[model samples]
Target: MVADREGGARRKPARAVAVYVAGGAVLLTGCASMPDNGDLRGVESTPRQDTQVRVFAMPPREDAQPSEIVQGFLEALTSDDPQYATAKQYLTGQAAKTWRPELSTMVLADGPATEADPAGVREDSVNFSFTLTGAKVAVVDAEQSYAPAQGSYSRQVRLVRDRKSGQWRINGLPQGVVMGKSDFQRNYTSVNKYYFASNSAVGTASQTAAVADPVYVRRRVDPMTQMVRSLLNGPTSWLGPVVRSSFPSGTALRKGAGPLTPDDQNKLTVPLNGKATQVGRAKCNEMAAQLLFTLQGLTPAVDEVEVQAGGEQLCELDEDGAAAVAARGSAKHPEFLYFIDGEHRLVRIPPGGSRSTNADAVPGELGGGERALRSAAVSRDEHTGAGVALDGKTLYVGSLVSGSSLGEPVVRSAGKTEDERLTTPSWDARGDLWVADRDPEHPRLLVLREGKGEPMEVQVPGLDGQIRSVRVAADGVRIALVVENDDKQSLLVGRIERTTKDVPGGKPGPGSGVSVFELRPAAPALEEVTTMSWAGDGRLVVVGREEGGVQQMKYVQVDGSTPEGPAPDALTGVKEIAAAEDGRLPLVAYSEDGIVRLPDGAQWQTVVKDGSAPVYPG
Candidate 1:
């Protein structure tokens, strides 16, 4: 068998290749290299994405030259060698011990261009150097999360001769391995880690909201086992403060357990240490639900997961059981699409969007003509909703049932002008309400508890711009804001950190406070982001414009990575856009032509000839 990556068992790569045994020929893997992030120019695009072929990296020859060793080492970095044992053969004793393939990954627009240093011809000649250069694309951090990066890439590898064998070996290299985007795509596969919302303070399984944290892992290696360890390790740093792992602290896989694999019924039993033996049935079910969600997309489909501790079965969760215990973001289906119709009243359309029926006003005063509304957001449960008055000065909340009257105004904006008032409201899965007051002098983001309590101003520490629109994610741990600054509008995603107040002394308080922090760009490359909505877990469909470009719509990950699917078809005069966390639902938008929806295998069709502000339940 071929030597795997790190320690001889990492058996996958970041990209793809092809080797035909019948023809006995070697060919380079052809993958697109055009930079979508506008990092640089001159990268040529390839024809197509060929088949997936496993590459076997060979050990260094007895008398390898310094140039040969440099090339081989770079190649080995792209292989799925278990533990990267084969790659370490080319490194000196000191370098081998210090090297860590799992530390991080640097990805470029194309395969790095390697060139030997001109100063290699010294008379003493104890060392040689090779410079690697390429256009930066993105980076997979030590946690395996991907983020878009920019600028030129360059690194140097210095080689030295072994004292005893006189063989060439690499003594110095960068902290993490580097590869082209194609290789990264071939070698690694993206997977989601599941965690519960910290906003609820460790509630029961039925009440808890599970959030997804996306990360990358090797495809050919023991990915299931690797993913289990990653899930057990907890959420990534960016999402750590807002989410909690169901797994108990210090809980880990049994020490002598072999690689985890699914049985004939697609049930994978995970053996945890004694730390998990004490959790009651509710907690154990939540833990099993997390495992089932995280490993469902991996190979050999895991339909069931069982948690075992100290040689005894703790709990078992199948698809239906998991759904009942911990509801996932994708399981949410939008029942109706809401928008402001020609009469300026809140109205609803059947969610399928392909129906030919006319729009109907929702129950309650907010949907009636007497109280004109401009924008609105329905709660996750669909039993309640919040709407902004036509003048944008008052925000109202009430029930969705028949004959239900709109309650008193929950929030009032002092902005004198229409443009300087409250933005649309949003609801999180936790049932909390969110909105932004654009009263230029006292601009602030506000949240109402359960859409009925006093409006609390959310502190955004690093937000230097005014929030024009707000959309809290279904998980409730993240919120997206369209922030306007210096005449440009950018889409930013922030963490919703909730902490209980500290008592006068050193004790914890029962009261909780919430704040938004880590406001990073979700669409950094766009010059102006007009509107956006959470398309799914860790994904967004944004309407924005690139520098010196026309308005366009594209999907982006919360971490600022490029999206996986094709871009949406172009629509003109898109003033606002909305999407459901359930990706299968058609995308709804309010363009110049009024309200429209995109159905499966169909172009944008008119939902209403005179409507604006289309939205699905959060």
Candidate 2:
């Protein structure tokens, strides 16, 4: 317990961790940080659990003891003080000038523990020292990228008595800030930085698909300005190989620009430096589109974005113009959720609707029930459909239009039985089809460019297990796979690298060999993953079971972290599940209850009495 400014006792929250002072009983409890402004609002309130209460940092008391000064400085680091000005007051002149808290954040498992240095305890000593220690859980870099880390953390902090004032101040410490896990959560919010897929264009098409790259930024800081700067800096390292930035090589916001905010008409004007002034009109528009899509998630949403350089407007883009350039995220909304009905035929229904009978049979051969189907996929435009035979021996490509005919099997599996054959087919944003052949004799991942030509075997380096299922993201760069080995299945997200290297056997392959490598575990805790689908820009809806546990459905991010939202309601006997990239759409699944849908804020509703595989257009 600590005394309040009014001489009352302040109780700590249940989960609060304590930072001990070096020579006294003073304890600093963890708290959520906010921006120091009257206009601050609850966008995504931190886990501090005091949403209605604001805690202001108390400055150092007059002639304070060294222990109190150390305790106050640590508490101020977790407060909502703007630029941490109050915290700086605890540091000496040279120490305040050298501290760079924005460079990085060191997240600990609990509040740091402080111990007095034996050498600084003498009465004649003018300088006192202490050791701050904790167990590090992760680190957030200057680029705002969060990566898991593990190790012991120890730093020496030194304080000296001011000669003129006879007051103690922190004179030596590390550059970055340190806090507990809960404090870190309250201080940052996740935001997606939009980028264009490097391979979205096919044939002569010019438009590209937008990919979402999520990052964490300090919510109370200058978020609008920080976000624009991150976008200009480009994508994270894991996603950098497959995506490209529309901004010129060295483009950046003009130096010393004020905080970025939309005008009364909901227009955001981005003034770039001279490096971006020479771009053509078409390229400039693409840059503006990226900005609009990236900023659509924040509060006070802007309706239009203008790009300016060298004091002149280069281009402008609204929602409509952004959609025409890069199709994805809020710019595009899916029409329906698809599934294989009781008759093992392809069917469709309005996403988030209750109708069932009127949703069967899409069109042409796929809807005609000419051949028994085990799984199916529809292209983004809902113009093409790919179906895998019930026996899993062949994959057929057909048009989703009336009076259209199904062509010969696009690809066939040589597996001896249904248990080892082609997996569900998937379509990419660039109009390509992907499938995996699980034949024990020759397992391979295959891709069909433009849904035609010879089947190309995709190279997957460093894979030690058999591929059971595959789902391609809307971005056309990241692919999710459920690989099984030694009776255990793992959910892995890998980068799609289109390379010039030859096939695995040193033989020339068609359409420039593409490899899926650098795979990272998306659900490292789950013992087995039954099925999954891309649910958002950087999130996936997964169904799996842990060791000695019942099956569960949850959303996992591409970077192996749990998201902020609640998990979908639990369901039993779920064999296959599907979710649209648009979060507004309902989640469809094929469970023991047959085809079912989970509408927003409602329990599961039956869509039909029988169905197996459910999916949304890629």
Candidate 3:
């Protein structure tokens, strides 16, 4: 899903997982076991004695050994240490196996200081809600900072724990957050190519923090008493606050304060014997088509397509061919349309066109727009507008006019006043222009093809509300627009009549292609779908917050089936998601927080923090 390039989405990747528990150990100790009732068919029919096994909660051992179970897990994950051998002293059963070979490794680590550090604790409880027998420990965060040449580094750690077995054992860990490949391509790549320093990657935590925290970089951290007090007293203070809040109030409490949710990062070694195939140029072309086609399919169709439009054999499909594309609405095809290739570099046309041709030339069609879009002179109103596909040819953009007069050449404003509120400009591949006026009350999405002066307006019944979001398939036949009604929870999906020009029923026959589906229960009430985009094959990616503080990102497949329920991995690990522009793999997830990326996951350079939510074009 793509975020607005101008203002980055604001969110703090969740710091740590929250674990809650109720009923103290004393309450559990006196509990009794009961047999099933005869009337209940699901329950066991046998009647047993009302008896109980009382297990009392034990106090923390004063002489408990300092087991480095949590720290060992973090070290093994971060610096390629063989500390997994030492982890068994603490972990047991399936947890031992899960911790054995780190599923994926993280590049850095952050946690509480070790025993050697000045502020370090000798030992502590690992679980956040431990009783006398069972303990649960979790890693909160792990971060590392390296010196030049990737030599030595300092690491920080945070952990949480619950009382258990009169002891603490570390349980879960934290995940890293990063950008998706498509997002990197569209927003950061080449955009900041000049600002990056040699030997340093841009958009990384260290680099971005270097720029973001100017004061911290310029000045030394003075060891002042007030600073110490703030660390111990202030709201943002990590150490002091955690100790006071997490540690048990009684003598059972040990040195450890909170559950340390260390980053559980590990990497696996795999052998790749085959030579990698070279499809760089072909791949780039597919990516461009996917991105542009989706936009064109949305509103009024533009006249021409642009995106390195110089390569001669670039793929092309006429208007009729585009409408034939259909999605069965299955899990694979959650939406009606989508892009095959989602991420690729877009090199704007140079003032002088290139003289190259054939196989020797670049794959993208860079120079075919009817009129060149001026980079410096493009309209500036802060509202970032993108080109939309209509009828497989023309591109449509809402035009900006200084005046509201309904001139013959200029599309008239839909507003009652003479104010220049709206105008639709249609352009062809060669940059040829056609202006069409839209109905003020019921605005139409115009589909313009070359030589087709009269544009097509696809019908959207029951669309009497403000448009909250819009997504157009890579092909022009399908369009999805989210409209917010007075109830705010309303979300509906509709198919457009690409074959006919009908309000309800018109032309040779009202196109059966368009049908609006109810998207209310699937989506939350009053929550907006902020980032909406289409993947190749018509998968719908919708990211937004729900009413119950649930931040959701879901996909609707165009194959005509409901998607599977989201698993733990999909919910917590998804950093960024992009559609492959080359169509090799329609979907690509960026960084998976703490879980190491899959061996086959797409390659991407690390991104520094610039306060923007990751962008995924496809």
lDDT winner among the candidates?
1
lDDT of all predictions:
0.80, 0.78, 0.26
What's the count of clashing pairs in each model shown?
Answer: 31, 0, 109
- Tens-digit lDDT track of model 2 for 311-399: 99999999899888877743447777788877889988877755554675897989899988999998877888999999999999988
What is the C-alpha lDDT profile of model 1 across 1-618, one tens digit per residue?
Answer: 111232122222323333333232223332232111111211122222233444545577666667667656767777667688878998999999998888898888776665676655343466877777777888999999888789999888888886667788999998888877767776777888899887462112336778888898887677899899899989999999878887889999999875899999999999999989999999999999999988985654799999999999999999998888767667778788899888988889888846674889998876877678899999888888788999999999988887888868999999989889999899987678999999999998998877886787788998988899899988888899999999899999999987767578633356666799988888988979888999988789999999999999999888887755588899999999999888889998989888888987899988878899888986
TM-score of each: 0.88, 0.83, 0.28
Give the Cα error of residue 45 in candidate 1, in Å.
11
Q: Between the candidate structures 2 and 3, which one is better when assessed by TM-score?
A: 2
Point out the worst 10-residue segment of candidate 2 by lDDT. 36-45
The TM-score ranking, best first, is: 1, 2, 3
Worst 10 residues of 1 by lDDT: 34-43
After superposing candidate 1, which stretches have Cα over 4 Å from the reference? Answer: 1-52, 122-124, 199-206, 256-258, 500-512
Model 1 vs. true fold: TM: 0.88
TM-score of 2: 0.83
